[model samples]
Target: MLFKESFSMAFTALLANKMRSLLTMLGIIIGVGAVIAMVSVGMGVKSDVVNSISSLGSNMLIVSPGSTNRGGVRGAAGSRTNLKYDDAKAIKEKIKNIDFVSPSVSRSYQIVYGNQNWNSSVMGVTPEYMSIRSLEVSTGSFVSESDNNKRNRVAVIGSTVATNLFGTTNPVGQNIRVNNQPFKVIGVLESKGQSSMGQDQDDVVIVPLTTAMERLMAMDYVSSVNIQVSDANKMDQVQEDIEVLLRQRHKIIGGKEDDFNVRNMTSLMETMSQTTTMLTILLGSIAGISLVVGGIGIMNIMMVSVTERTREIGIRKALGATFQNIMMQFLIESVVIGVIGGIIGIGMGCGLSMLVGKFGNFTTVITPLPVLVSFSFSVGIGLFFGIYPARKAAKLDPIEALRYE
Candidate 1:
């Protein structure tokens, strides 16, 4: 028989049992839909994280105190107050690639303005902090070098703090008490929603580092230093330079670890991206199990089909149909079932992903790669499972088959 005739025979047979064919495809439909939805959600989360971190600044690096060993007990990173203001000053003056350096120290304090009182984080920083953090003042000005030098008691409040304390009133030029000590509000920062860690960025107040260390916390060490490099490509080199410089300043020799840690945003980006990619592959693999089950369903139904058409097979063989032609007919039927399932599965998967994004507050992106992969895999499953049934049908004895009831 010609290939076209075999295809026609297969099409007619499937059309006669439409219900069974659809039932066999159910597993494939569900598998494809689940895989697409889950992978899309993972990618969306990764994109959100990257965007949030990028919004903070460009080519940023963070330096914080490293762990301290107290007798054999080691503390967590930043547990030791080893990072100081002078370290930030030295990096700013000596580093050629660095654009700005902002030394910072933070503590929670009760802020009182008029009759309103709110407990919020108070940050001590320099004027360069505003640019390094991508923060802008809506009114008045940020802390200047003179403010840090004079140890002036001035505050810059975030939008959330401004709303909570001053309501609709212009907060700049107003006096707010920090830890019962009065400080004039010099600026109000623009609204920043939240960090990737889900912490509110607009729920704090800023002051000069000198004021925070000497007046508010009574501490001499800075909590961290935020650095912005001039070029993103040179961040790793700059980070190494900063590490060597800090290690020398701290007098660490040989293989001993330094007292401070340097973190570049590029490394963080790569780590986060890798994590999400792993999650996507994991989800897709789990969903693939259903495709195998669907293939088994096709095989089971094809076996039954061969049994039911035993007399037909006998008649065709007795009429001079070759073994190859009989095998081709059955194989065509199975592959048709798979191809139809794949097309429908693609449609269902895209629709399901969109629905999830709309109602589940998830981000979903349906790219062509997943669709192509799933469709090709489904067709392969059909061929793999169909071989046994097709061979069995072609091997039937014509004499016994014709005598069947």
Candidate 2:
């Protein structure tokens, strides 16, 4: 028989038992829908993480104090005071591919302006911190080199601090008390909202590095140093160079762990991306299990179909229908069920993903690749599951099948 004739006959048989065909396709529908929705959610979360990391800055590196080991136990990372202002200054001067550098110290303090007060992180940094951290002033200006050199008590406040302390008032040119030490607010930084870790990025106050170290915190060592690389390709080399320079400056010898750690933000971003990609794959794989179950359901239904149509198979064989014709007919019926179910599932998944994004407060992304994959996989499942039953129907003996009750 012609392939068209086989397909037409298969379609007609399914229509004869419309309810049963619909029921048989239900598993595939649910399976495909689940896979699509799960994958979209994973993609959305990955996108959010990438955006959060990108917002920090481009081609950036951070140098922080490493742990100190006294007697056999080591302190937590960044607990030591090994990094100093001169170390940062030397890095800016000696390191190649360095765009900007900022040595910083931080402490939490209660900031009071008029009758309002808020607790926020106060960081001591040079003017170069602005460019290195991609911070912009919405009013006034950032700290200057002269400000740090003179140990001026000036500050640049973040949006959250501004709101909590000043409330709808522009914080520039105002005076605020940091730990009860009055400092003039020279600028209000643009809002950065939140980081990937959900910390409020805008709840900060910036001051001159000298003022913070000498006046506010009364400390000698910097907590960390920020570096901005001029080129993306130079990040790794620069990180290594910074490690070498810092080791020399700190007088650390070979075969010993350094007192400072150099962190490449690009590397951090890559690590985060890899983690998110793995999670996406894991979720997709879990959701894919349903598809296999659906395929099994298809096989069971096809087997039942063959058993019910045994007499019909015998009659067709008696009427000159070849084995290939019988096999193709049954296979076409199963494939048609899969194709129709897959199309419906795709629509259902898209709608579900949209709903989740709208009401679930989550970012959902639906790319074309997942949809195509799910559809193709569904079709393959149908063909695979239908093969066994189709073969059995084709191999039936006409004489015995016709004589059986």
RMSD of each: 3.5, 2.7
| Model 2, span 1-405: residue lDDT tens | 998998899889889989888888888898889889988998988888887877767898988887334357677644578788899989999999998999999989999988889999999999988887788899999999999999999999999999888888888889999999999999999998877567798999999999999999988999999899999998889999998898899898978888777888899889988998898888878888888888888899889989998999999999999999999999998899899999998999999999999999778899999999999999999999999999999999999889866
Candidate 1 lDDT: 0.87
Residue-by-residue lDDT tens digits, candidate 1, 114-211: 99999899999998888888888888899999999999999999999999999999999999999999999989988888775777889999999999
After TM-score superposition, the amount by which residue 300's alpha carbon in candidate 1 deviates from its true location, in angstroms, is 1.7
Q: Please tell me which predicted candidate would have the highest TM-score against the true structure.
A: 2
Worst 10 residues of 2 by lDDT: 67-76
- RMSD in angstroms, candidate 1? 3.5
Cα deviation of 286, candidate 1, in Å: 1.8
